[model samples]
Target: MSEAARQAWPTVRSIPVSAVTDAKPPGRLRPARLEQVAGSSGTGRDTTGGGTATGVGTAGAKPSAGSASSAGSASSGTHARANPAAELGFSGDPGQHGDAGDGMLHAQRAWDATLATNRLDNLGVNAERQRLVIKDVTAAVGLLVDGWPADVRACVQSVIDHTDVSVLALDLGNLDGAGDVLDDLAARYPDRVAVWRVAERPHWRGGTATWGESRAKLLRLDESDVHVLMETSIVLRGDGLTPLVAAVAEGAVAAGWRGVDPADGREAGPGRVPALTGDLMAVRRSAALSALPEDANYGRNADLELSLGLRGELVVPQGALPVERLGTHDVQADYRERESQRNYDGVLRMLSAS
Candidate 1:
């Protein structure tokens, strides 16, 4: 490596490996934050390549309701993060490229986008940007693939077309060959699709897997700050998922496309509601981990159960988004009635206790 190349990299701290073998992947150790000055407001900012994220509200960041501030740039008054390359002799210009010498690889094109982005001289220092430890925030659409092969395919494809988030799907017993469809989707879009298959069928389908169990499993497997509990019945005409994620980032425990009254089961307007509909719901992963009901068998009323259990406010965004529900899932009428009554019983108990 050249002198400029060596100086471009910062001295990052790393964890020491012990004698025992561990399966953790190799990582580039980055600090969560730099030291804070006295009396500074303790707020966190998570950033990465680009795009707006949830839960990044700083003092000057006036995020509109159901939306978060963009992450590529600073909110206000704050400078961009520090760049080690700036301290070295290299000037941060894309047009100027030095000789590769021995170690550097040569580029083929005039633009040389890959080399330009990787070049260290392009880095610039930001004074205040280093003060806050920037963490990267991620989100995923959680889908339960049951017997509806057509709906499952449509749901996954619509999300891929409309939103930037990846799809996290759980296929139960490969019902109706839906699991096979999910597998094909994953193969086609490996970077955006992930599926977990299970032989245990949903309890409504006369197998053992319960709604609470599978829902909790999805939440556990996902590492994103936001987990969207979207059903396969819903399809997106546009980017409908981001606002719900932004709502969660703004501090709501759960945000959904719509809500309903638990008392009379009427559709509620946009705002805080007693319970949120599961058709299109977004929740903070931390809150869901602590609150999601893992024992409920059916999702019919169990969504309300999860909604009531959450620690913070449950809300619906004021502006309408481009999402639609084709129809309800085709569960057995008897099973639906029985499981809903059972879960509603739990909801009543919770309401009474509170």
Candidate 2:
């Protein structure tokens, strides 16, 4: 071949030869063009210049075509040898060869971003919906002068001092200036206190018979988160409202003290009795307004009846919650008799039905 023709032809280099099953013609070997060599199409298998007669194989060379299934198997084998992360478009760490740290960091960031988006979605407010604003609680104290204005004042003061819950005093013809004292306190703490005057004295005789009237009056005025049935004779000593509210949060229908008999002078322990004292019972507004019977007039047994009706429901006491007992003139005297009758009547009625 001429120099230009030689330059145009592909070059051939010596490669190791192995065994061949085919026979070759007995003649001197002739030079063949590189393109005519089988397995020379960049597959690296035709390292030797000789044809199939000379058995030669390159390192890491792909399998040459034999049968359809064998060719397919060879292609699949090459694919299986590929790096998994690389097949998924993930380039590993620049500093660490064959390490998937970069891919992990990317996946972690994606997960964090998804969580943040979910949190923001949960916090998003609806523009068309109205928000609820809790109204301040209204309170009414039924009092007759009876020279107990100081006691009433103390009760009112304790409520004001210990709780953000407001109080209102409803005076029922207290001739001994109880109304005036309550009025003065209302004036002093105008934001927290209010005074109302009833035309006649309320008929409360320390018995459960007057529950209907008292509950009616309370229901007429206060519709807050809770209604405090505070007796004017009882004075609170500490943060009574907090524990009461906390009890309510624990699924209590009502909560109070002196209502629950604490064992061994402790706040709470074994052998506790469940009862509701009108002294300072916090009744959940919904439960009180809904469950309490309208015709039930027994004042002393009202708490017990209400609690009984709410059986299977929660009723907690503010254990060891200090509260001073002032003079319980009409109501305190007949408490035992009224309570006994109320309980007996309730039990008998329940048994008859059962």
Highest-scoring model, TM-score: 1
Instruction: Please give the clash total of every predicted structure, in order.
Output: 3, 10
Task: Report lDDT (CA) for all predictions.
Answer: 0.65, 0.47
Candidate 2 regions exceeding 4 Å error are: 1-147, 205-209, 260-274, 296-298, 317-319, 330-344, 347-354
Candidate 2, residues 1-354: lDDT per residue as tens digits? 233321211101111113331132212211212222222111112335343311111222333364222443455575664544443334555553433455544544444554454344335321001011112222233322223778888988988887667784555554366767777787789888755554344444321223444464554455355567777778778655555544443344555664443122223211113455556666555556555655554555555556545433334331245667887645444655765476547634543553
Q: Which stretches of candidate 1 lie over 4 Å from their true place?
A: 1-136
Pairs that collide in candidate 1 are: 32-133, 33-133, 55-249
| Native-referenced Cα lDDT, model 1 | 0.65
Model 1 worst lDDT run, 10 consecutive residues: 6-15
- What TM-score quantifies how close candidate 2 is to the native fold? 0.50
TM-score of each: 0.63, 0.50
